[model samples]
Target: MDLYFMGTNAGVPSLERNVTSLALRLLDERRSFWLFDCGEGTQHQILRSPLKLSKLENVFITHLHGDHLFGLPGLISSRAYQGGDTPLTIYGPQGLKRYITTVLELSESRINYKMDIVEHDGGTVFEDESFRVEAALLDHRIPSYGYRIIEKDQPGKLDTALLKKYGISPGPLYGKLKRGESVQAPNDKTVHAAEVLGKSKKGRIVTILGDTRPCPAALELAKDADVLVHESTFLHELAGIAHTYHHSTARQAAEAAKYAGVKELFLTHFSSRYKNNEQMDRIQQEAEAIFKDTTLAVEHVLYPVDR
Candidate 1:
């Protein structure tokens, strides 16, 4: 899977970056994309990138802040205009449905597709054969949430060479062996699947956090994640200000990633105050001091999460 940063700035849009928005591209896995946040002017950002609004299957709003959700109506309308007939589901906190519907109604926007809203309290919000999404309440000013996306383990490939040794040619029998089912040989001998298949592939874990201060829930959700996407709205020196605003500093975000034992930590939701690369590097340096695998999110950049 890959994560594309559409907008990485916090609160407002700057010349260098827009507000909070990220697209988890799952074209190879699910043939669609899952959007994390739709900040204002997010649609415009997508236009400048390789992302497609029609490929978006779900939108997960982190909080009810205007900067985090103001572009929902516009995006939905544009998706309809682009001939996206497939249904879309949005998962978020309470009042999300009202917010989207109200804006659509007031603007007289007509959508040709179905839309479903899910307001989850906590725990597993969505589950299927391939993946499961769990939500946890974050320590933000509002009822913000963080999502832990767990991909189910995949079965290993069949050992063609081993099967050939058993006088089995590649065909329907290989499919059965790959499914861990015992198949009968041409001589009526029972062939066990385990002896002909490789080890199962481990699943990938990704945790995306909303605006929040360092808290236990964040750490719990981020544990053992392949990628931990946390907000770093301030530097280490301005940690007190970050606490006052209920946001995290680079150091605090790094602390969470280190405690959680994540493989990679991506710091996003940059405060607009850091305008130049020098200022941004300082924030990244703070996080790297604690967690060496830390990266600062840049707009239009795609970060891959591979197992």
Candidate 2:
């Protein structure tokens, strides 16, 4: 899986960074992409990247903040004209359904495909054979949320060499073996999948958090995650301002990553105060001082979540 950063700025658009929007690209795993937020100019950002709006199957809204929400109606309406015929599902906070419905109604936008909107009060929102998604509230001015995406463990790969020895050529029988089933050969010989399959690999975890101050829910969502995408809106010296605004400093984000024992930390949603590269470097240094595996996540980059 990969994370495509569409926008990295916190509130408003910048010359270099747009507002807060990103996509979890599942091309390798599911051949689809799930969006995290729909900031302003989000569609334009997608046009500039390798992501296709047609492959966007899910949209997750963190809060009703303008930067995180204003682009939703536009993106949704545009999806229809852009060859998006597949059903789409949106998950968000309590007022999201009303907001989206109102905008689409006023605009008279007609969607060509089925769309499901789910408003949750912080808990498990989605689950399927491949993944489960849980949400928790955070310490933001608005009721922002953080999502924990858990990929289910898959069946181990079949041993090709062992199958060759058993006179089992690759065919429909291979599918049965992949599903961890025993199959009988034409000669009346049975072979067990457990004896030939390799060990199952552990599933990967990715946590994407919305705007917030240092909070327990943030750490809970990030616990042991392969990738923790957190917001770093200020420097350590301006932590009081961060708390007052219900935002997190770079150092605070790193501390949370360290306490949560996450494998990697990608800091985004930066304040526009850090304009130049030198100023941005300060934010990176502060986070790295606390957690060495921190990265200043940039816009339009694809970050991989490895198993």
Candidate 3:
């Protein structure tokens, strides 16, 4: 699992950064890729990365803010042009269906792939065999939400030495044993899979928050996450402005990560005022003062999440 930042700017696009779009790459896993918040010019950002628009299977919108969702119509239409025939599912708060439909209608765009929209009311929203996604209401100017993605734990590798010790040869029976099945041997003896398998490995947890102020819901959603991606729209000195705009400062984001027990914290959604890399470095330094694992997010940067 990996997270690729396609856009990191907060409200508007700047020469240094784009708007708020992120791609959760699940290569070598069950899913291919899931996108979060397709901001304006997001497809243009994807053109610079190694991502394929045809592989985008799922999208989660945080809010209806233009910076968060303006790129939806273009991306959906472009995917069809790129020969994306697979079904795409989008989850967001209420009114997303009408918004998307209006865009499609106004643009007169026709997609070859099937699109499914699911409007959620902020709790545990989606669950599959491989992963589960939960959402919570955030303290934003608009009706926003934060999402927590939990990958399911998988069984560990079998102890081949133990299997061989029990006179079990490498064949389909090994597959059965790895699957935790008890089978009868040639000598009428029962061999249990649990006796030869190693302990199960824990899955990774990724928490991503939309634009919001310091809120309990955000902290709860990010609890014990392996990776926490939070918006930091201002410097710590601009706490008053951050509070007024329903956004978080760099220090506030780090504090949330520390409280949530997250292993790593990525701060994005930067204001365009900070044009130089030095300013971003200073913000990251401030965040790191509060949380050691805190870092600033840059466009196209990918962070791997290992299970």
TM-score of each: 0.95, 0.95, 0.94
lDDT of 1 by residue, 1-307 (tens): 9999988899998888899999999988999999999999989888898888888899999899988999888999999777688999999999998888888899999988889999878789889989999999999899999999999998898888877877899889988887889999877878999888899999999999999999999999999999999999999889899999999999999999999999999999999999998999899889999999999988888889989
Q: Which candidate leads the pack in lDDT?
A: 2
Itemize residue pairs with steric clashes in candidate 1: none
- What is the C-alpha local distance difference test score of each model? 0.92, 0.93, 0.91
Ranking by TM-score: 2, 1, 3
- Candidate 1 Cα lDDT to native: 0.92
Q: After superposition, how far is residue 123 of candidate 2 from its true place, in Å?
A: 1.9
Error of 1 at 28 (Å): 1.4
lDDT of 2 by residue, 64-88 (tens): 9999989999999999888899999
TM-score of 1: 0.95
Model 3, span 149-215: residue lDDT tens: 9998877888888777777888999888878899777776899878888898898999999999999
Better of 2 and 3 by TM-score: 2
Supply candidate 2's per-residue lDDT for 126.
Answer: 95
Candidate 3: the clashing residue pairs are: none
